[model samples]
Target: MHLRKVYTIARHEYTVTVRRPGFIVLTATVPVLGLVVAVLVLVAGRGLLAQVDTLVGAMEKPIGVVDKSGYFSPVLPAFADDFQRYEDETEVYRAVDEGRLQAAIVIPPDYVQTGRVYVYSPQNVFQRVSLEDSHRLRAFLAVHLSRPWVPEEVLVRLSEPLVTLTPVASRQETAGPWASFTQVLVPYMVAILLVISVFASSGYLIQGLAEEKENRLVEIIISSVTPMEWFVGKVVGLGAAGLTQMGIWMLTSLALSGGAMLALVAVSPIPWYRWGLFLLYYALGYALYAVLQAGLGALGTSTRETQQIAGLASVVAFVPFMLSGLVFTVPDAPLVRGLSYFPLTAPTMMIFRLAVFSVPTVDVVVSLTLLVVSIPVAGWIGAKLFRLGILFYGKRPSLAEIWYALRSA
Candidate 1:
């Protein structure tokens, strides 16, 4: 319980972990690989874009338009090459059959009233028309319909709308599509990174625990330091190491992308406060799992066995991800909300919900409270398990015995 003893133990654990060759290699590998990939992309990006443009151009056969209504007489000069006028629907079909046309568009005579356009394209059974093809036909229709009413510049802007959103409060401008996409993407990325880092650091904890127990070193360590001090020290020190790894990976990405990552964060549609919540959830999630791992890890007789036992916690953590499709589609559904409040799944589920839509303030508060409250209870249970299991040898303890021990602790 002494602050000095806890700090000394924590310092020792952190120094030992960060200095390990495995830790150094694992930490550096990602950034080094990212740098190599970034360099290659920068060197060849222009050439790659050019090649893609050429390939697309070569593959895109001109679309045939049958203007039965005679409304689209002189095709717009802008779309002249992309669209070829065909007088006969039969001729258009023939051209399409011969692979000379990518698609055939038939304009009905009642196009003014019904506005029904027939499209013919070859595709597999499950396939739909390509977006580019549909977009081109729609653009052609829109231009002809609206050109007579709106100014030319206005009509052009209708298709290529480069909109920016500026909220009254933040006064930050965000690009339309990119910002929306980032709102959904960033939360998912944070959740995944949080889980990975927590497990990686906790894996170190369990591995060290199992090694010490196996070698009969726990007795010596415990004789010098109280169990609570040892447990708290390991958790704090390893959590710092995990935080350090996550920081390095993020910095590497920012450096590799030439500050593009920073720009994305600035324009992200996620509220500023949600980012803070993400950090809070990450810390609580890591602490809760670390406590669980410390207990379960001590129960195992070997490092591999310890990891296997500790991995059950990871399985529980990943349940939210497995049901992520539902979370994304129905963020406010009963099941998703329940998961969001459940301590084990709360961190990831809440993050997933936040990415998809705005979760209610009450739900956020409740979930955070649950995670905050669960850590101490888990710590007490873990302390009991660690205290008993660290010294006990031979057969693995049964659930009944563990329950009894918990009651006694």
Candidate 2:
């Protein structure tokens, strides 16, 4: 392995990537655009509720609410700030027909506990509803919570609604705390970006390799450096490029949303230590995936074949993200727990669960250690595959051939 050649490859990658105006614009400005969009959504959402009276006037017509309990349930008191009242659900429909209201609501007696709130509006016509519905529901729950009779169990029940972790014992999981888990969403985006990055870099790796092979330039580069040095350096340089782009995007995103940014800093509910854990896992995760991408790149005789291999790896990387919603809802389900221990899916699923709730220290230690150990092991295996894959081309090789590559010097 020649340091000189490695440095040269890295320098070339950095320069080529930075000098492309398209890459520069995308790398630098994308974060700003993302941040701006986020801020606009938050600001506009907050502002939309500012002028309640004006909003009331803007509604097309009156809507009705039915309590169905024979008692007059006070008109959502806030709804009074918006809609004119109608006699009943039927009358609300009539008023809608008469161009008097947009929709109607029916609050069944068990609406809160049952999660069965009903809405009625003209069929096949678009119906607009008021904002703060979530606020209204949450406020309603909070007030109900203040009542003397609501049990602690019911409150916790509503929060997760699934998993229902018993908190059997307390242990200091390296996962840290809740906010630390939000970074799971961070890697989710990372997974997609890095997968794309791997795709992009693998192209850079293989096409550069193959183009060299085809144009008779492979010998020129190899004469100056060993294949292993060149391969390792190219992978490192491009990975650095990916992380730099991702970091800039992350900081840019945070900077753009000033309010949330401040709130996150001030009231960060997640534990700080988990950041150490996140970095640990992120590095391991990225290394494991990037090396695989490198091996895939080294194997392909052509660019098209490289993509097929890269796409397969991308799907493998994305399995956790595809099931993120489930991971959020059922963090401790046997399947979730099982996959989280499995090397390929653990980073996303385990980290996400670690964020939302307390996991055992053993689980945390075992999972993180596995990923960390796997990184170099996988990279070495990939490097072997890569080193051998470089020379074997023309016909697609067998699993025996791939296995032989893995064992190659």
Candidate 3:
């Protein structure tokens, strides 16, 4: 491989792709869109919480009570301003209808024997009572009634404890809810971003190859440089462009939501070592896919056919993403462990495992070893296909022909 020629070709590819309108629009708009989405979600959440608070607060208004049994009248004074005793049910209904009271309570004459009480309110207003409101009301009544018998300390002890216990098997304690959520979400996001970046960048390689072949430019270009050199140049160039795009996205995200992004990273359970491993896997995975895409592109005579082939390959790459939920729940499951060893699925599955669970060191070593070994094998096959097919036009080569080319190249 000629380094100068490869660099020249790579530089040319990078220049062409980076200047494209699509690249500019995508890079610029993604951050803005993310900001908009985040703001909208925040506003919506606050609005919902505020509404719930309002509902609960509204439930605390004075309720008119008609006590024929006369037992609750003595205890009613404890509620003070929140309680209003009425002699008859008509007066209670009148107060509720006129909006002077939120609701009316009726205590039957036999309430001391049978502890049944009835509540009355407009159907529309009554339906707004939330579970929280019910719980608060029950607690208030329980406290007042039990004040005469049960001790306050006993009541406090009987209520559910506010403390939470987190078990730790090793030196590291189990992750909190936010940390767990971050762990799962970040891995899936990284996997999706990796897949998208690979597909998007590799598409440029495929389209460039197919376009060169269609325009009869490959014939002239291949005369000066070896096919392998040309292929390496394209991969390096496009891969750099992909990384640049992702870097821009990361920077933009930080610029737009620095505090939130920092908090998320701070709370995440992923260690620095796992992040380094992720980068390694990302590079290897991109190289593997890039070469394969190049080979497929060389075989196709038109942009449409090349894209269809690339799309199918992208689908295969995304299989690990589809299994991400399973990885989050059971990182050590047999199927998940198996996928982590497969070259196409290894990068994403390994990321998920490292992010959410403690993967055995041996498994990590073996997964990386398999990927490292597979990259070159894939490169060799891709080079063979590219060298043979770059010159051929019109008809796509069959698998048998490809095999023959692989052997003969």
Candidate number of the best TM-score = 3
Task: Give the runs in model 2 whose Cα sits over 4 Å from its true position.
Answer: 28-53, 56-215, 259-262, 265-268, 393-395
* Per-residue lDDT of model 2, residues 253-292, tens digit only: 6667665754654444446676566566666667777777
lDDT of 3 by residue, 1-409 (tens): 8899999999998898889897888777878798898888798889888977865655667777787765555443336576678888888898887777877878788865776677887645454354226644455345545655776576554342344767665524756668768877877777777888887776677767776788888779988999899888887887788778888888888787856877887788788888898889888888888877877767776888877776666677788778877877887889999999988889888888888788999889999999999988888887888887787888788889988998885
Residue-pair clashes, model 2: 5
Query: Global CA lDDT of candidate 2, please?
Result: 0.62
**Span of ten consecutive residues with least summed lDDT in model 1:** 123-132
Q: What is the lDDT of candidate 1?
A: 0.80
* TM-score (all chains, Cα) for each model: 0.76, 0.63, 0.79
Q: lDDT (0-100) at residue 253 of candidate 1?
A: 84
lDDT of 3: 0.77
- Candidate 2 versus the native: TM-score? 0.63
lDDT, each prediction: 0.80, 0.62, 0.77
Off by over 4 Å in 3: 32-129, 132-154, 170-177
Q: Pick the candidate with the highest lDDT.
A: 1
